[model samples]
Structures are given as structure tokens and as C-alpha cells.
Target: MSILVIGATGTIGSLITQRLADAGAEVKALVRQAGKREFPAIVTEVVADLTDVPSMRVALSSVRTLFLLNAVTPDEVTQALITLNLAREAGIERIVYLSVIHADRFTNVPHFTGKHTVERMIQSLEMPATILRPAYFMQNDRMVQQTIQDYSMYPMPIGSAGVSMIDARDIADVAVAELLRRDKASSALEPLTLELVGPQPLTGASAANIWSAALGREITYGGDDVAAFEGQLASYGPTWLAYDMRLMMTGIQRFGMQSTEGTVEKLQTLIGHPLRTYEDFVREAVAEG
Candidate 1:
């Protein structure tokens, strides 16, 4: 079976591509550029942009399954919708869409709202898809490594609600499983949505504590200040994205990126292991530095 992976150069998507290739599956990577990286011999790299219909059509051509991961952008919804529509027209049935946890509830966040729109589109279209709604990525903590090491502070305003941050590797593993399941099936399977989360929820303070334990030093939680966070982000990146992130943080503060009952068990059964913990992530990150 042939599978096409969108966002194949990204953090999670790269992992998914590697896993799929390791399983002896034929993989195609849809990238905007080529010669930037290398892939396994069985993998084919297709240079294509989401906005370019002809290129995307070529990328979707002859693929039996797709792992769609639209990066958070101003046009995420548009990109996803176009790709999905093209995939359907091309007779691609099996799909795994990377969506955000609580995409429906976080209406104020642009990316969340965009993903919700895509989810609705998939549902209404009656596509055979699996929506993986993951929580805040634990890898996001890498951005704060310097701050924690320099100032002994954890600077993310994840607030008191406590986010069940998941590891990107876990997300990739589950996605590969879904894609393979859909590809090997005799027919199109039912559409499913899974809430992928960590083993436990952790607040900003708890995250700091984990760092403290791992780094063997005191690390305090930089209190919930969405404004300061936004300002900091804007100083380094696009203002629009910074503002969009601010709204996301505001939503996280109000209602954390949490999981429902049996979420952990369900994910464990799918991944075939216990979920990775924030402590382990912090430990490995600190040790690597």
C-alpha cells in the first residue's frame, strides 16, 4: 500500500514517515521544497505546496492512504480543506488528520477554530478518517530550556488548569497505526476521533517542579501572564501568530487541554504501552543540553 504524508518535514510528521517506512510500507512525502533532507529508499519526496492544486494532485495521485498534518497557520483551514477535497476526488479513502484537543471548544483560537472546521468537513463528507486530537506538545517545553537553565524559571503560562501535554512521538506512533490499519483493511473503515493525551495533567508549577527535579536546581513557574508571553513571542516571530497563540493560551488558562475519563487507557491500548511522562521528557532534554 502507498501512503502520502503531508507536513512530512515537521516534527511529528517526520516521525510518522520514518515509522511507516520502517514498517516496510511505501511512503510519499508531500513537501514544498526538495533537497532539504533525505528519506529512506522506499520513500518518495513530492515537491508540492498546499495552495498549488496541480502539485497537490500529483502528490495525492496513486496513494491509498494519507496522513494529513496541517501546520498551525493563518490558512490552515484552507490548506486542509483543499488537500482533503483533492484526496477525496482522487479516490483516497483512508485518512488520519492531526487536529488539536478541544478543537471544538477553543473557538477563540484561530488554529483551533480552523481545525474544528476541518473536522466538521470530514464528518459531513462522510470520509473514512481518524482525527487525532492531541493535547499541548511536551516538546514545546524545549523552547523554555534556556530560560529554565539561565533564570531557573518555567516560562509557559499554561495556568492552573493543568494541561495533559502529550509527546509528539506518541502522536506519530498512533497516526502510523491508524494509517496502516486503514490501508490494509478490505474496505473503508468507520470514521473515528481519538483524544491523545499524556499520562497525567501538569500545571505550570508542576512542570517547573519536574524541571527542578531533573536539573537538580530550583525552577519556578513563571506565573500565568498571557500578555507577557505574547509580547515575548511577538518579539521573535510574526505578530499575528503571537496574537493567535495568546488567544490559545487564554483558552488554556480558562479551560486546560485536558482529557476525558478512559482517555489514557484508550490511548495505551492503541499505542501498546504506557504514555510517556513530562518528567522523562524534562530529564532527557536536560541531559542532552
Candidate 2:
């Protein structure tokens, strides 16, 4: 069966696309424009922009599954809904959505609640789906590469609270398993929700220490100041994006990022391996430098 991947050029989406193709699955990537950028020769690349819903139908042709990943944009909700109706109409049998951890609890966070709304809509439509709720990405630190490299410190107001962040690569692997697994329930059943998170809870201080050990330098933790954090965030993204992120961080500070044993069991069920740790990610990242 063929599978379609939206947001194919993005961080987690790109990893998911490559993993499926490498496994010899018949994959179709729904990108904005195929000719503008080169993709792997294994998968078929289709020109379909989420901004233009009309072009999406062509991408769904002959597809049985969809890996739906939308970013934190003003149009996120609108885009997902549009894609949902089209995918259902096209007779796509299954969908795997990339969502944030604790989406149901965080009603005010735009990206979280927005995805929660989509999750409900999908269930209401009786569409077959698996929701993967990934925790804070360990790679989020990449945004402050300059601070880490030049100042020898990590700058993000993660507070002293421990968070269960996940490696995007692991999320990609589990996404492929969900897509290709055919023994799942009927398309109309309640979707399966799984948590994709790190092996342990890590505070900002602990994470800084990990990076310091990996790089042989002391990396200080940036304190918990939402306004200042948002200010730095706005430098790289729009003001609203920064605000949204600060909200998420604040949620983490309040609720702590602990995961259940069930989450680990789910990961083992999908990949039959222990989840990757932050130290492992940091070592590889430093090695690549």
C-alpha cells in the first residue's frame, strides 16, 4: 500500500519520510514543489502545497496511509481540517498525526489545543488514526547554537523543572511503525494515542551539564524568565510564535515533564529498543561538529 507524507521537508516529517523510504516502503511525499528542492530518488514527490487544498487530491491518489504533521502557524488548524476532509474523501484508510504531549490538558496553548481539536474531529469522523504525542524536542537547543558555542551556556527559560524531551529521530521510527502496521483496529475505531519522549526526566540544568560534558566545557542554564525568553525567541520567529512557545515552557514549568511506564512500553512495542537519551543525542551532535 502507498503512503502519503505531509510536511515532508520539515524536521520530524523529513526523518519520517526517509525512514519509510529506507525500509523499502512505497512512499509519496506531498511537498510544495518537487523541482524547487531535491528529495530522495526512492519516493515519489508530488507538488502539493497545504496553502492550496485543491492540489492535495493528486497527492492522495493511490495512497492508503497519511503521516500528518502540521507546524505552529496561524493557519495550522485550518490546514489540518482541510487535509482531514480531503484524506477521508480520498478513501485513505489510516492517518498518523504528530501532536504535542498532553494536548488534552493544555487547552490554551495554540499548537496543543489546535491539535486536540483536530484529534476530536478525526474521531468524530470515524477516521482510522494513531496520535503520537511527542515531548519537547532535544534539538530545540539548536536555536541557541551561538550561545552554546560562543558563550558556553544554554539560553532558554526551561526553569529548573525536569522535562521528558524526545529525539525527533525516535518519533520518526515510531511513526513508520504506525503507518505500516496493518493488524490495527478498524478505521472507525477510537485512535490509538502514544507518547514519544526521552528515557528520563531532565531539567535545564541537567541538560546543560550533559552538553558541557559532551563538549568539555561548563554550559550554564538560562534562568526562568518568560518575558526575556520570549524576547530571544522573537528574534528567530514572529512575536506570536515566541509567545506560544513561552506558554508551552510555562506549562512545563508548572506540570513537570514526567512520563509513565506505559509510554516506554509503547516505544518498545514499536521499535523493540530502549529510547535514546539526551546524552546520546548530545554526543552525536558534538561529534558531527
lDDT (Cα atoms) of all candidates against the true structure: 0.93, 0.82
Residue-pair clashes per candidate, as listed?
0, 0
Candidate 1 to truth, TM: 0.99
Write one digit per residue (lDDT tens) for candidate 2, span 168-194. Answer: 888888998888783243443447888
- RMSD of candidate 1 to the truth, in angstroms, is 0.7
lDDT of 1 by residue, 46-129 (tens): 999998999999889999999999998888889999999999999999999999999999998899999999999999999999
User: Model 2, residue 275: displacement in angstroms?
Assistant: 1.1
The C-alpha RMSD of each candidate to the native structure, in angstroms, is: 0.7, 2.0
Off by over 4 Å in 2: 183-190
Clashing pairs in 1: none
Which structure among the candidates has the greatest TM-score? 1
